[model samples]
Target: MIKPKHNYTGKPTAYLDHNILNYFLRHPETSAFEKIFEEQQVVYSDETLREIKRSKGKENDFLNKLKKLNAMHFKIFVDENHQSTNDAIISDADPFEQYARLCEQLHIIDKIYTATNNTLRKFHGDKSLPSIEELDQQQSSDFIMILEELMQKKSNTDTLTSEQLTKLNNYISRTLQHQKTIQELSTKMMLNYQRDDNASMINTYRAKVGIGPLELNNVKGPKIIEKIWSLHKDLDGYKGRNFSIEDFLGINYIPSNLNGCIPTSSKIISAYNVLNVIGYFNDSDLKLNRRFTSATSDANHVALASFADTLYSSDIGMIKKGRAIYEFLDVRTKIITINVIDNRPL
Candidate 1:
C-alpha cells in the first residue's frame, strides 16, 4: 500500500471507531484493513469496549483483532494514582466525567419516578403494579434498592398518612415532568451537522484551498432556544429555564485543553455550532433515535481521536462531522473514512 506524503512527528496513530472493529471481524482476511492496521498505531476507547460488549457472541473475536493491532484503549475515568491498568490508561479529569455524573443523577431520578408511580398505582388497588418486595428483588443499583427499601418500610407500616401520600404524589409528578425535560435535552445533545444549508459557501472556500467542499444541509429556528436552554440548564449549571441565543453564545463551557489535544475542544464546539447554525436543535419534533445514541458516541469518539494522528470510521455521519470540525478548527488529525483506507491499492 502506498503511504500518504504527510510528515509525522512520531508514529502515525489511527483511532478506530467501533464499527470498523466489527467490520474487520466480519472480514478478518481482508488484506486492505490488515495492512492499514499493520502500518498505523491504532487506538480505541472505553466506548469501543462498551460497543464490543454489545456485540453478543463476537466479543472475543473483536478483542483478538484489537489485540493483534496492539490497540490502545482509553478509559472514561482514571484512578486517583494515575496508574495505567490492563484495560486503559489514566486520564485527567474532564467534561466526560461531569456528563457521567449528570447521567447517574438522571438515572436515579428515573428510578425514583418508576418506584413511586408503581407504589401509587398499588395504593389505588391496581393489581398490576409490583409490590415493594418485588421491586427490591428486581432493583440492581444501590440507589434503586434504597428507594425500594423505603417503599417496603412504608408498606410494612401500612400507615401511609394522607400528608405523606400527598408528598409522594407531588414528588412523582415533579420527577415525571423532569424526565420529559431530560429526554428532550438528551435528544438535542444527539443532533449533529448532518445537514447544512451553507454547503456552497463552505465548498467555495474549500475549493480555493484545493480541498473538496463539505456537503451540509441547512437547518434554522426559534426552537433552537429550547435546545440551548436545555444544554445550559443541564451542562452549564444555569438555573434559569429560559435562555436566548446570546446567552448560549456567551457561555464559555468548552474546556481549553482536552488532555493535551488542544484542538479537540474547539472541534467539539465546532460540531455543535455546525448543527446549531443549521437550526438542528430548534426542531422540537426531531429526536434522537433510541436504537442508538450516535451523536453522543460520535462526539466522544472525536474527543478520543484527538490523541491520535488519524481517525478511521465507517460512519459517514462521523466522517462528515469530523472532517468539518477538523477543517474548521485547523486540527492536524487526519479524519479518513474506513472505505477510503479499504479501497487503497495493495
Candidate 2:
C-alpha cells in the first residue's frame, strides 16, 4: 500500500461528533489508534463537549485518550458562542443545525475531517470548501473511507468482494445494536405521537431525541377543545373545564393529522366514535384517568385479563387510544376491539 509521506504540511484536522467518538472509544478494534490520534487537532463544539462532560463522566476518559496522541496531532476547542447564532440562522430548525454551525467554525481553522453526515453540506456551503458530495464523487468518503482507501493502495491488491463488505457492514450494525434499538423505539414513539396529534408528546419526543420541532400553525378545530374540556370537567382532578385556544397553543399542541398514514390514530378515532355509540365519557376525569394511568408489567397482564370490566371504569379514552395502537401493531393481537382507545393526547 502506498503511504503518503509524513512530510505533507497541509492542515489535516480530525472532527469528531460526540456520539461517533463515543462509539469508536468503546469499540476495541477501532480504538487501537486512540493514542496516535490524540495528538491531532480534534474538532468538537463547546456545547457537545459540555454535554458530554456533564452527562457522561466517561468522556473524561476519552479526553485522556486524546492527550496520549502526539503533541501536534490534536487541538480541542470549545464552541459556545457560534452555536447559538448558527441555530438562529437556519430555517429548517432542527437541533442538528448546532452541529452544522460547529462544522462551519472548524473549517475556518483548518481542513478538518468531520465524522458527521448532516453537517457536511454546512461546511461545504461556502465556495472555498469542497462539498462533501463533490468530494465523495471525486474521491471517497472520509475517515473510515480513508482507512478503506489505504487498504487498496497497493497496485496488485485484491479489492474486498461485495459479500465481504456486506458482512463487515452487518457486523458493525449488529455491534451497535443497543443504540440502534433505543433509537428505533424512540422513533416509533414519535411516529405514534405525531399520528395522534398529541402535541405535548411530540415536543417531548423531539426534545428527547435532540431535535427541535419546526414551528407549525395548524390547529385542531374548536370541537376538539370543547370535547376535551367537557371530558376534563367530568374528571375529578381536572382543575378547569374552561381553557382558551391559547392554552392549547401554550402546550404546543398541533392538530393531529387524521390521514391514512397513521393507522393508529385512525383506530383511535374509530374507537372513540364507537364509545360515543355506548354511554362512555359521560363523566369528567373518569374517562381521562381510566385511560391514561401508568401500568406495571403485572398490572398490564391483569389489565388484559379483566379489560372488559375495567374498560368502563379506567381511562376509557386513553385505553382506547393505546388499544388502537396495540391493534395496528398486533403484538398482542387477541385484544378485544372494545377495550381499545387511543391513549395519546392530541
Candidate 3:
C-alpha cells in the first residue's frame, strides 16, 4: 500500500481531467474553470496526455491547449526498485513540454495502454491471459502454416521426412496446449465478469440478507453504505462489524499504505472499478458491462490526482467516484464538480 508523496507547497493544487480540459479547449474564452486556475496550483497528468493522443491528428493541437490553463504535470513515482515501470514524471513538471517530450521520446501511449488494460484485469482477478497479444497472433499464424504443411504431407507419404514429422508433431502439441490455455483463460474471464454483475450480486445479497438493490447516486450516504457493508459482511466474508471506508478501497490484506505494500495508484484504479461493480458512484447503467471497465481514463485520473490538493472535473461520474475513492483511501484531495460549482464562480 503506497500513497504518493508530493513536494506540494504554496497554493492548493487542482488536477484537471481530460473532459474539463477539453471543455476549456473548446471554449477558450469561457471563464467556467477560471477560478480553479486562478487560485489552485492547477496540474495535469499523463492521463490527460493519453486522451489527447487519442485525438489522433489533433494530438498536437490539444497538447498545445494545456498551456492555456497554466497547469503543471503531476505524476506519481513508483518505488526506486521498479524504475523500469517507465511511468515516472518530473516532480515540478511543465505540463505542455513534459507531455510533448514524452510523445517524442517514446511510444508510451501504447505501452501504458497495454499495461493499464492488464492491470485492470488483475484488479478484477479476470483471468484474461496476460495480454501476450503479439505472441498469440504469431503463434496462431505459425500453427496455421504448420497445419497446411501437415495436410500437404498427408497427400504424399514420399514427401514427408522423418525430421519434418517430428518437428510438426511438436508444433502441433504446443499449439494445442496454447489453445487450451487461451480457452481456460477466456472461461475464467467470463466467470469473473458474471460474478461482478451488479444485479446478480445484489440479488445474491438480497437472498441471504433480504437487502435489495442499492441507491446508485447517494452511494456515500448511510443508506448505500449500510447496504454495501451488509452485502460484504453477509456474503463476501468481510469480518469487520463496523464499516471501514479504507477497506472499501485499500487492499484489505495490507495493514496500511504507510507500510508500502501496494502502490496507491494501482489500488485507486482497481478500487474505482470495484466501487462501480458494487454500485457506488456507478459509472455504468447496469445494462451492459457489470463493471465500468471502460472508464479506464477516469481511473487513471483518480490515481494521478491522488496527491493533489484538489481535482476539478466536469464529469459527474468522475466527481462521484473520485470523491468516494479518495475518502476510502484517505487521500486529502478535494473534488470540485463543474455542475456543483454554481454559475462558474470565480
Candidate 4:
C-alpha cells in the first residue's frame, strides 16, 4: 500500500509484463517498483492473464497484486457499425474475477469439444476434415451464436461467473477447437522453417530482398529495415510476404476504430517476429521458445503493450524487439527494461 506524494488527475498509463511485476513483488529492490508504480496508472490485459496462467501456483498472488494495485483491465473491440469503442480500457475490473471467468470458459470449451468431436465422429466416421469456417457457415455447435455473444461483451452486464459471459467462449472454442484448422486438428504440425543446407535463413532472406549473400556477421540495423521497405527491393518484406515494412512503418496514429486497430496490432506483431527471425536482437529467454505458440503470445504482448504510455519488461529480447517495432511504427510508448538489482528478499 504505497501512495504517491503528488496529486494526479491524469497519471500516465503503464502496461507491465510478468517479469517486471514479479520483480516488484519479490525483488529486494521492491520499494523501487512501488515508487514507480504509484506514479503511473498500471493496467492489465488478457495477455497479462495469459502469461500469469503459466505461473501455476503463483496465479492467485499476481491476480491479487494486480487487484490491490488497481490495475485496469484493457481490451479493444469493434462495435456494431465496425467502429471501436473508446472505453476499451476499463478501470473497475477485478483480475481475480476475470481469471476465474477465463478459466471457466476454457473448461467449458474443453467439455463442449468432447461432445462436438463425438458428434463429428458419428456423422463423418472420425475421418472427416473439418474447417471452422464451414461450421460457422452452417451455424453448427452454436458458432454463430457464440460469435454474436463474443461481440456483445461490451454491453454484457451479467456477473462473469454466470452462464452468459464465460460459456460464450466455450461454445466458440468447442465449436472450432480453439479455432484450429485441419493443420492443427488432424496432424502434429511441424515447424520445418529452417531452409536447405545451401540456403541459410539469413542468406535466403538477403537474396529475396535483392542483397548479395554474406556471412551471418553482416546485414543489420535500421538500414536493413529500410531496405526491406524499399519498393524497388524484391524481398521488401519478410520472405516476400506480399507486403513490406512500408505497409505499416511510419504509421504514428493509434487507431480509434477496430478496422484500423486489428491491422495495426497485426503489423506490430509481424514486425516483432521479423526481428526475431532475422536475429537482429536475440538477447533474452523469450527467443528460446520460438515455436508458433509461445512466439505468437510474446509478439502479441508487444502489440498490445504499444497502446500504453509506457511498457515495462525485464525480457531483454522483448524489450529490444518491441523498441524496434514501436520506433518503426512510430508508436510513442516508452520502453523500460529492468533487471534485478537485489535478488535477496525485502
Candidate 5:
C-alpha cells in the first residue's frame, strides 16, 4: 500500500471543510476549535478557498485565520500549476488519479470486502455477495471477482509467507476499524438530527448552495428521500460517461505539492472502481443534489481529505458521504463534526 509521508512529530493532520471554517470564523468564542487547531496539524485544500471566495466578506478573514493557525494548504488538482478556479477545484481529474493511486499503494483488499459487504447488507439484505447481474450492471463484475478470489486466498493463511500474512492482517484490522468508525458516526448523526429532518437536509444542501436551515416537517422527509433516490436511479445510465481513472492517469496528471506523492495510474483507477462498487455517489443516505452545481465541490472536499488524518465538517450530508467514501476506499481519515471537537475536554 502507498503510505503517506508523515511529519516526524506524529501529530495528526486535519482538513477543515469549508462549513467548519465558516463556523470557526463566525463564532470566535468557540475557542474549543481554536485550541484543537493549535494542537493538530490543520490543512485546507484549494476547494475551501473557492468556497470562501463565494462570500467575499469572509474570504480574507478566513485566509488570515488560516495563516494565524499556521495551516498548510495544498492543491487537489492533477496539475499543481492549474489556476485556482472554482471549476478547477471541483474537477474530477486530479481526485480520481490521487485516490486511484492511494488504493493501488495501500493494497486495499480487505476494505473493499468490508465496503461491499456493508453495501450489500444495506441494499440486498442477507446476500453475502452481489449477484453477477448486479455486478455486471454496476460494471464491477471483474473487480468483485478479483476481491472474492483474494478473500479465498486470504482464508488459506498457511499458503502465505509470514510477511504477506502480516500485511494482510494489518489491512483487515484497518478495515474493521473503519467499519467501526462509520457505525459510530452514523449513530451520532441519527441521534443529533433524529427529529430534525429540515436541519439534516439543510445541512446537506449547504454543500450545494449556502442556504439557512428550513423548517421541513416529518411529512416531507419521505418525499425528499424518494426524490433523492429517484435522482440517483435516473443517472444510472450515464455511468459510462462519468470520469474514470484512465481518464485522469492517461493525462499523466499529478499534484505538484507534498513532494510529488503519486501512485500508478492502474492502481488509482482500481481504487476509483472500488469506490463505484461501494456507491459513494449513489447509494449513501446522504443526499447529493448534483443538479445544483456543475462543480461537485462537496465531493471534491471529501476526496482531498482522503489525504489527511481527519476531516472536520458541519454539513451532515458531507460528513455521512465523506465517511462512506473514506471507509470504502480504505482512506484512514476520520470524518467528524465541529460538535465532536466542541465536546472534547480542553
Candidate 6:
C-alpha cells in the first residue's frame, strides 16, 4: 500500500466533465469562473472527444468553443480495451465519466472538487424554510393578516372632494402597484424564480459571496472516520486499526474542492453513484464525497458496476454539481481555504 505523505502539496490533476467545460467556455462573461478554470490542467481521452463529437447542437457548440479557447490545455489519454473483462464491466461509454473513471484506476484523482448550488435548508422565519407546500401552509396565516390590514386601512380613509379623492385613489393605486412590483421582486429573490432548475443561480450567488457549494458542507468526514474505523475493525483485511481521528481527518478527509480519484471504468462509475447516495460523505460540508468501489464479499476481489444503461438512476442522478470549496477554521476564528473544485461535469 502507498503510505500517506505529510508534505504532499502539489498541483492537482482534475477531470473536467464536458458540461463543466462548456459552462466555462459558454460563460466567458463569468470572469471569476474563468479564472478558476484557468488554474487546472484539463484531462480527456480520445473516446471522450468522440463522445463530444457524437453530441449534437448546443453540446457540440460548447465543446467546439472550448477546443478553440485553449486547445493546448487538454490532455487526451487512451488506456486500453477491456474486451476480455467480465460482462459485468462492459458498458456503453460516456467520455467524461469514462475519463474520470480512468483517472481513478490510475490513482490520479488526489481530490475531486465539484461546485454545486446549496441544497441545504436556508435559514428563514422561525425554522429553516420547508418545502414549498409547507411554506405555503406557514405563510397562509400571514397572508390573511396582510389582506385584513389592507382592508382596514382602505375603509378608514376620509371621504374627500372629487379632485382630492381622485388624487388620493391614484396615489393608493400607485402605492399598491409599487407594492405589487416589490412583492414580485421579493418573491423572485426569495423563492428563486427565474433560476435554472439545476439551481445555477444559487451557485452564482454563492460564488459572489465567496462560499463554495452547499453540498460540500454535508460531506460527513467524521462519519467517514467512523465508517472507516468500523471497516478496519470488522473487516478482516484492514490490519492497522490504530489510526487516530486526526490522522483520518488529515489523510482520509477529502475536501470537496479536492478531486480524490477518477472513475475510469464502469464499475468505478457505478461505485461513484452508489457512494454518492450511500452518504459516505456525511460529515463533509463541501459535498466533497464521491461514490467509490470497495472490497466485495470476497476480500481478495472487488466488483464494479455498469454505467451506460444504468447511469440515470434517480439516486445518483440527484448529485448536483457546482463550485465547492474546502475550509477549516483557524485559531483566529477565521476560515482558511484548502481547495476549490467546480462540479460542472466535463
- For residues 1-346, write the lDDT of model 2, one tens digit per residue: 1222343232333333333345445654654334434443433333343334433557555554434432122112112210111011101122244334544554422222232211222221222334434544333233344434333442234675565555445433432342234233333433443423323432343344332212111213334434433443333322353644333222212122222122222233333322222223211221232211121111232222221111211344334433433333342322222221242112
Candidate 4, residues 1-346, lDDT tens digits: the string is 1122443346788888877777656753447676678888898887788778867788988888888788887765434443334224445568888887778676545344443343222122122323333433343445444555554763365544444434445444543543344223222211121233423334344455554323222445564456434523353543454543554342322222324443567568656654554445543333122233355566778888877789988776678678767776677889987766557322
Against the true structure, candidate 2 reaches a TM-score of 0.20
Highest lDDT against the true fold, candidate: 3
Clashing pairs in 3: 1-261, 1-262
lDDT for each residue of candidate 1 in 79-182, tens digit (9 for 90 to 100): 22221211224222332343344455555554554543332222222344344345333432433465555555555665666666555545434434533443
**TM-score head-to-head 2 vs 3, winner:** 3
- TM-score of model 6 (CA atoms): 0.27
Between 1 and 2, whose lDDT is larger? 1
Candidate 2: 10-residue stretch with minimal lDDT: 81-90
lDDT of 5 by residue, 2-33 (tens): 22345235357788877667776777766777
Off by over 4 Å in 6: 1-14, 37-39, 46-55, 71-219, 222-267, 276-346
**Number of clashes recorded per candidate:** 10, 26, 2, 2, 6, 51
lDDT for each residue of candidate 3 in 1-346, tens digit (9 for 90 to 100)? 1335654566777777777766765666667567547877677776677677666677766766666656677566643222112233435555567766777734534443443344334333344433334434544555455556544655468765676565556545654564445434434433333443333433343344443335455435434434465556644334544536455543452322223466666668767766655556556543232242347778888888877777877777777777766665567778877653433433
Per-model TM-score on C-alpha atoms: 0.46, 0.20, 0.61, 0.59, 0.40, 0.27
lDDT for 272 (candidate 1): 50
The candidate that achieves the highest TM-score relative to the unseen native structure: 3
Cα lDDT, model 3, residue 95: 58
Which residue pairs of candidate 4 clash? 208-235, 209-235
Local lDDT at 331 for model 3: 72
Model 5 regions lying over 4 Å from their true place: 1-10, 76-291, 340-346
In candidate 5, residue 216 scores what lDDT?
A: 17
lDDT for residue 29 in candidate 6, whole number 0-100: 59
lDDT of 6 by residue, 183-249 (tens): 3433444464224343433344434333232433344443432443344333322235564533323
